[model samples]
Target: MAASFTTSWRCAFLALLALFVSGAYGQLSPTFYASTCPNLTTIVRDAMVTALNPAVGGERRMGASLLRLHFHDCFVEGCDGSVLLDNVPANGSTPAFFGEKNAFGNINSVRGFEVIDTIKAAVEQACPGVVSCADILTLAARDGTFLLGGPTWAVPLGRRDSTTASMDLANRDLPPPFANLVTNPPDGSDLIARFQRKGLSATEMTVLSGAHTIGSAQCQNYRLRLYNENRIDFQFAQGLKANCPQNGPAGDTFLAPLDSTGSTFDNKYYTDLTGLRGLLHSDQVLYPQNNQTQAKIVLKYKGDNTAFFADFAAAMIKMGNLSPLTGTAGQIRTNCRLVNPA
Candidate 1:
C-alpha cells in the first residue's frame, strides 16, 4: 500500500510539472500593453533623435538617421506599409548619390530600446506610473515596421516593467546582423543554439529576417558569405572582394550594404534571395531547398509580404519572452544605459 501511494504522488507531481511548462511556454499575454501609452510616433522619433545626438559621421547610422529610414519606409501610404516607399542607400552622401548608413542594421536599434526607456521615463515623470514598458517596445517596433513596408498588426498594451536591466538578456535577445551560415544553420536550433540554446524552427528564422527588410546589413557583418563562400556561394565573390576586401574593414568601420534595398521593409529581400543575390550566404541558403525549414519560409515571403509582418511581430513577442526578469528579480532602471543606483 505504501508503494502504491508513492506511485500516485509521483504521477500527481508530474502532472503539475506539465501544467507549469505549458503555461510558461505559452505566456502570450496579448492583453499586455501600457495603461497610459504616450504618443508613439512623436515620442519614439524624439527619443531616436536624442540617442543619435552624440553620433557624428560613423555613428550617425546608430540614432536619428536610422529612425528616419524606418519612418520613411513605414509612412509610404499613411504608414500602412506601402512598398512604394523610397529606399535609402546606406552610403547616402550629403550630395547627389547615396543614403547614409543604409546598412546600419540593429546595432542602433537595440540602442533605440535603451533610448525608449529614457523617453518612457520622461513620460512617466510627467504623467507618473501610468505606462507599460512593453508598450514602448511594441509601439516602436510597430512604427519601425510601418516605416519598413510592414503592416501594423494589433499590439495590445498593459505590460509592466521589471525592476532591472540585464546586459546578457539584451545581448542574447538580439540576433547578429550576419550569422555565419556555415557555423550556424538556419534551423529551428539556430536562435536557440547561439544565445539561449533554445532551438527555433526554420519558420522562426525566416520571419525574424523579415525584420531585416527594414534594417541595414554591413559588408563587415556579411562579407564572408559573399567573398569567402566558394563552397556554398558561387557568384558575387570576386566583385564582393573588390569592395569588401577583408573579413572586417581595414581602417574605416563603416561599409556598404548587403542587400541593395535594406532600408525599406518590403518583400524585396525575399525576392533578392531567390535570384541568388542574398547578401549573406546564410540568407541564400533559405532558397537552395537545402534547409527544409528555411526553404518554406522563403517561399512564403516570396509569395506574400503581409504574412511576413504578422509573423515578425509574433516572433518578436516570443523572442522578448526569453529569460525575462520577473517577481522582484529586476529593477526598473531609471537610466537605461546604466544599472539603477538604488
Candidate 2:
C-alpha cells in the first residue's frame, strides 16, 4: 500500500509539471507567422513609420500610446484583444457603448486605435484570414518602441481576439493612477499587488513604469498631485498649478509631459523621482522618502539604463503572454474595432 501511494504521488507531480511547461510555451512562438505571413514585420514597420512621422506633432506620441494600450489590454483580460472591441447593440434592444475605453484608467486617455487599424488593413491585404489583431498589437507595440529608440524583443505571436468584452472587468482590474496615493501613499506593497494579480513581479512593475518617460498626462489626472501633495518639487508643482486650477477650466484638457524628457524613452523618469519630481502620486510612491524595497530597485535602474531596457523587454514579453487565446480558440477579427460576427 505504501509503494502504491508513493507512485501515485509521483504521477500527480509529473502531470502538474507537464501542464506548467505546456502552458508557458505551447501557444506562443516568435515565428508563428513564418509561413502564413512572411511580410508581417515589414508591413507593421511601414505603417508605424507612416503613422509616427515626426512632421506630424501628435502622431509622434503614438509609440507610448501603443504601449499603454497593450498594458491596459493585458491587465484587464489577459491581452486577448478584448480591449479593442467596440460595444454594439447586445440584442437590438440595448444601446451601443464602449468597453474598456470607458474604464477609469482608459477613458479619454487611450489612443492609437487608428495606428492599429492601419497595420491590420495592411496585414489583411497581404494575407487575409490569417493574422490576428491581437498579434498585430503585440508586434506593433514592440516595433513602435524600437522605432522611437527604445528596447526591442521577440514578441511571440499566434494570439487571437475575443468576441466578447467586459467594461466591468476593465474598470475593476486596470490600476488607477491614484492607487496607493491618497493620504500617505502605501508602500509599494499595494501597487505590487495590482501588478502581481496580472502575473507581473514587483521588479517588472518598476521597470515597466519607466515607460512614463515618454508620454504626457492631462491636467485632470495629476491636478490633485500638484495642489494637494507636498512632496513634489516646489517650482514644478507651481508650474503645474498654473495650468491646472483647483476648479475645472475649459483648458483643463491641456497636457503636461509625465517626465521632463517626454519625447525620449530613457532613465530620466527614475532620475526625476530621486529629485522628488515625480508627476503622479503613484509615480512618487515608487521611491518614497523612507527606504522601501521597491525604492532600492528603482535606484538600481536610475543608475543603469541598459538593465532597465533589458528587464522591460522581458517583462513586456511576459505581459503579452498572459492567457492568450491561441491554437483553435478565438478568431482573427478582420476589424479590430468590432467583433467578427458569427
Candidate 3:
C-alpha cells in the first residue's frame, strides 16, 4: 500500500512555514515578573538610569557609580523618591546636598519619576503603552543596587508614580548623609548611620563603599571630608597636596582614581574606605569604632572581593524599596521629569 500526496499536507507545511517566519520577525511576549505582563525588564532598567542621570546635578550625577547612592538610600525600604525630591518643604534645609556636610541639601538627587519621563519619552517612540514608569524606577534602583554589590531581588512591574514630592515625608523617609550634625563629637553616624537605619550593619556599610569603585564626585562634594585641615575630623592625606586646595570654595578634578578600579564597579571602594581614602566622610566612618561591624566587612572584602560584592547585592535589594509608595498610594508618571506632565 502506497500513500498519496494530499492537499492537506501541503497546506499544513505552508502554515508551519508561516508560523516560523512570524516568530522570526516578531518574538514571543517578554517575561515580566508577572506572567501576564510582557517583558519590560530592559525598558524599566534603562529608563531608570536615564532618569537618574539628570537628577544628580545634571552633568555631575551622570556617572553610573553615583546612582548606587540613590539605590542605597532608597532601598532601605522602597523607592520613595525621597532622596531625589527635596524641593518640597522640610523641617531643616529642604534642598539637601550629598557632599556638603555643613550645608546638607538634597537638591540634585534625581527621582524615579524623572527617569520615567525620559524613559517614557524614549520607550513611547519604541513601544507605546507597553510599559510603566513606576516599574522603571524600581528596576533601575535594583540594578543600581546590584551594581553596588547589593541584592538583586525581583520587583513586580506596573508601579505608579507619585504626583508630588513629599518634603514632610521625605525627611522621615530618607536618612541624611550625616545625622546628629554638630561641631563636637561628630554625633551622627555618617553614611554608616543611615545604612544602619536601613537595617544594614556597619559591615554592610563598609563593603557597600565598594560602589565608589567607578563614579565621579563633585570636588566640593568630597572636599570637606577629603581636604580637611580645619580639625573637622575628616581630613585628607598629604598625598593629595597637589590636587585639592588647602582653602575654601574648591572645584572638581581634585581627586583621581579613588579606587584601584575607579573606572569599573567593584570592591575597591571598600579598600579605599579602609585607607581613609573614601571620597565622602560618611563612607570613611564605617571603620574602627561604632561601625566596627562594617569595618570587619570591609576587611573581609579586602581579603575576598567576592564576599563584598555578594553582600552588596543583598543590601541593595533591601535599600531600593525603603519606604516606597506602591500598589495604590503613588502616581505613575507618564513623564518622569515634569510632574503629571502639562
Candidate 4:
C-alpha cells in the first residue's frame, strides 16, 4: 500500500509540471495562422517590401526601426501590442492619458509605425479581424530583416493585442543606452539582468545587440558618449564631433551609421566593438575596457558570420516568446494605434 501511494504521488507531480510548462511556454506556433489566415506570411512580406523599398535605401532604415518596435512592444507587458497605443493629450480633450509612443526609450526614437499601419491594413483586407496586430508586428520584424539581407526565422504567432498601454512600465523596464551595470567597469550585467528577467541569457543579449549593425543613430543618442567617454576610437570620435558640435550648432538631428556597413546585415557590428568603434555607451559596455564574458562573445561573432546568424535567429525567437497574451486573453485591434471601441 505504501509503495502504491508513493507511485501515485510521483505521477501526479509530473503531470502538474507538464501542464504548467505547456500552458505557459508552448502556446505559440509557427503555423498558428495556417488555416485562419493562410496568406499571412506572404501578405506581411509584400507589405514590408513596399514599405521597406529596397530600391531607394528604405529597407536599410526601416529594418532596424521595425525590429526596435517589436523589442519595445515585447519587453513591456508582453508582446501584446500595447506599445502601439496613442493617448489623448492632457489638454481637457478626452480622458487624458500618456501612450508608450512618448516613453523614454521610445519618444522620437522608435519609428516604423506608418509601415505597421500599412501592413495591418493589408492583412485586414485578406483575413479581416482574424489576424491580430501583435502577430503582424512580430511577422513584420522577421520579414523586414529578411528583405534587408539578414537571417530569416519562423515567427511563432497567435498573440493577442492589449487594449491598454503603459507608458510608466515602458519607461521603467526598457533598458536605455546609458544604464549602469553591476561591475566596476560596467560589464553590462544590468542589461543582462533586464533581459534575463524576460527569460533571455547574457549570450542572447549579445546576439540581439547585433541588430545595431544595420541602423542609424541620431546625434542625441550618442552625443554623450562622443563628448565624455574615453574608450571610443579617436578618429571616429573626431568625425562625429565635426557633425555634432559641442554646443547647439548641429543640435541633435545629425545621423551616424551604427556600423561600418549600416545598410547591410552582417558581423561588422561585432568587429566594430572589437576595435572600440561601438556607437552607444550601452553597446560599448558589452565589450568594456576590461571585460571577459561579453568581450569573448563579441570576438566569436566577429570571427564567424555563420555562427552569429544562427545564434541571432535563435535569440530573436526567444525574445519573441516573452510573456505573450494568447487564447482570448486580449483583443485583436482593428487599428494598431488605438484600442477597439465597444
Candidate 5:
C-alpha cells in the first residue's frame, strides 16, 4: 500500500509539471499560422526588404533597429507588444498613461516603428485580426537578422498583444548602455545581474551582446567612454572624438558604428571586444581581463563564426519565449501602435 501511494504521488507531480511546461511554451508552434495565415512570412519579408532598401526612403540600418525593437519589447514585458503603445492623454475616466516609447533607454533611440506599422498593415490585409503584434515583432526580428546576413531560426508563434503598456517597467528592466560601467574596474556584474533577472545566463548575455555587431550608437551613448574610459582603443577613441566632442550636447546626436562592419551581422563584435575596440562601456566590459569566463566566450565567438551564429540563434529563440501570453489571454491589436478600442 505504501509503495503504491508513493508511485501515485510521483506520477501526479510529474503530470502537473508537464502541464505547467505545456501551458508556458507548448502552445506556440512554428506552423501555428500555416492554415490560418500561410503567407505571413512572405509578407513580413517583403516589407522588411522594402524597409531595408535605401533607394526608397528606407535604410539598411533599419534591420538593426527592428531587431533592437524586438529585444527592447521582450525585456520589459515578456514580448507582449507593450513597447509599441503610444502615450494616451486623459479622456474623462481614462487617465493619462505614458508608454515604453519614451522610456529612458528608448526615447529617441528605438526606431523602425513605421516599418512595423507597414508590416502590420500588410499582415492585417491578408489575415485580418488573426495575428498578434507580439508575434509580428518576433518574426520581424528573425527576418531582419536573416536579411542582414545573420543566422535565421524558427520563431515559435501564437503570442498575444498586451492592451496595456508600462513606461516604468521599461525604464527599470531594460539594461542601459552604461549598466556595467559603474564599477571601478568595470567587472560587468551589474549587466550580468540585469540579464539574469530576465532569466538569461551570463553566457547568453555575452552572446546577445553580439547583436551590437551590426548597429550604430549615438555619440551621447558612448561619449563618456571615448573621453574618460581607459579600456577603449586609443585610435578608436580619437576617431570617435572627432565627431563627439568631450563636453557638450552639440555632438550628442552624432552617430558611430558599433563595430568595423556595422551594417553586416557577423562575429566582428567579439573581435572588437578582443581588441578593446567595443564602442560601449557595457560591451567592452564583457571581455575585461579579470572575467575569464566571459572573456573566453568572447574569444571563442571571435574565432568561430559558426559557433556564434548557432548560439545567437538559440539565444534569440529562448528570449522570444520569455513569459508569453497565449491561449485566450491578451488581444490582437488592429494597429501595432495602439490597443484596440473597447
Candidate 6:
C-alpha cells in the first residue's frame, strides 16, 4: 500500500510540472529571464542612453525611431524580430526573398538598426545565446520611450526570434501617414480599421498615435497636406511649405517635426490634433469634428498628462502582447539580422 501511494503522488507531481512548462512556453512573464539574464534590462537601457547621446553623433530623435521599430515589428508577424532580417539571395534550395527594410512604409523611414545591433552585441557578451532578439527589441522600445520622457512599463519577455520576414506583410500591415485622406473631411475609420485588424481597440489606436509627439515627418509625406489641405493651420502649412517644395522630389527628404516639441514624448500631439495642426492627415483625422467618440478621448488625453501616460503605458503593454512567438515555436538568432544556419 505504501509503495502504491508513493507512485501515485509522483505521477501527480510530474503531471503538474508538465502543465507548468507548457503554460510557460505559450504565455509571457515579466520575470521570464530573472535567472538566465538578470541584467538584461540594464544592458538595453545603457545602450539606448549611449545611442541617444549627441556627443557621439547619436540623436535624441533615435528614441522615436527605436519605438517605431518595435511597433512596426510587432504589427507585422507578431513581434518576432523579422524586421531586422536583411534581404536573402536565392540559393539552390532557398528562394530569393526581400525584407521589410525596403517596404513602402519602411524604406526611407523606420531606422535605428545600428542601435539595436549594438544592444544585441552587448546582450550577447553577457548572456550569449540565452536571450532572444525579439525580446531585446521590445525592451529597447520600452527603455527608449522612458528615456525620452515617456511612461515606462514592465515588459513581459520570453519571445523568440523569427526565422523569416515578410516585406509583403510589412507593406500591408503598417499604417500609412497619408491614410484616410480621400473623404471630403478625413475620418479615423481607415486608421481605426487598420489597428482593429491588429487586435488593438480604437481607443488603444488613438493613444498609440501619441507616439508621433516625437520624431519628424519627411516632406514627401506631408507635402500634399501642406499644398492642398484646408484643415491645416495656415501658419503651420506655410512653415512646412518653406522646406517642402510645391513640386518634384527636390525637398522630398526634408524633415519637419511631427509636433512643436518633437524631441520630447508628451501629450502635445493631442493638442496639435485639437487645433488642426496635426502633421499627418491620419493624425488630424483622429479628432475630426464628426468623430465625437475619438475627439472626446483625444481631449481627455490632452487635458490629463498623467492619465495619458497611464493609458499609453497600458496600451503599449497590450500592443507588445500581440501575437508573440513564445516558447519553442522559434529559435533565438545569434545575429538579429540573419537566421542561424540550418
The candidate scoring highest on TM-score is: 5
Model 5 residue pairs with clashes: none
Using Cα atoms with residue i matched to residue i, what is each candidate's TM-score against the true structure? 0.60, 0.88, 0.64, 0.88, 0.91, 0.90
Which 10-residue span in candidate 3 carries the lowest summed lDDT? Answer: 96-105
lDDT, model 4: 0.82
lDDT of 4 by residue, 69-95 (tens): 999999998888888888766666567
For candidate 3, the per-residue lDDT at 35 reads 48
Error of model 2, residue 333, in angstroms? 0.3
Q: Any runs in candidate 3 off by more than 4 Å, and if so which?
A: 1-37, 44-66, 72-77, 82-105, 108-117, 125-134, 141-158, 167-193, 229-236, 250-258, 289-292
Per-residue lDDT over 247-292 for candidate 6, one digit per residue giving the tens place of the 0 to 100 score: 9688999989998888999999999988889998888888887778
Q: Once superposed on the true structure, which residue ranges of model 5 sit more than 4 Å away at CA?
A: 1-24, 181-189
Compare candidates 2 and 5 on lDDT and give the better one. 5
lDDT string for model 5 (1-342, tens) is: 996886565445444543444346958877789999999999999998888888988788998998999999999879899889898889999898899998999999999888889899999999999989999999989888988999777677889999888888888888888877236664443787778788999889999989998879999999998888988889989999999999888899998999999899999999898899999988998998877877898999999887788778778878888888888899999998888889
Measured with C-alpha atoms, the lDDT of residue 320 in candidate 5 is 89
Candidate 2 ranges with C-alpha deviation above 4 Å: 1-23, 56-58, 90-98, 181-189
| Residues 300-341 of candidate 3: C-alpha lDDT, one tens digit per residue | 887775555555554443444445554556664545433453
Clash statistics: count for each candidate: 24, 0, 39, 0, 0, 0
Q: Which residue window of length 10 is worst by lDDT in model 5?
A: 13-22
- lDDT ranking from best candidate downward: 5, 6, 4, 2, 3, 1
- Which pairs in model 4 have colliding backbones? none
Worst 10 residues of 1 by lDDT: 76-85
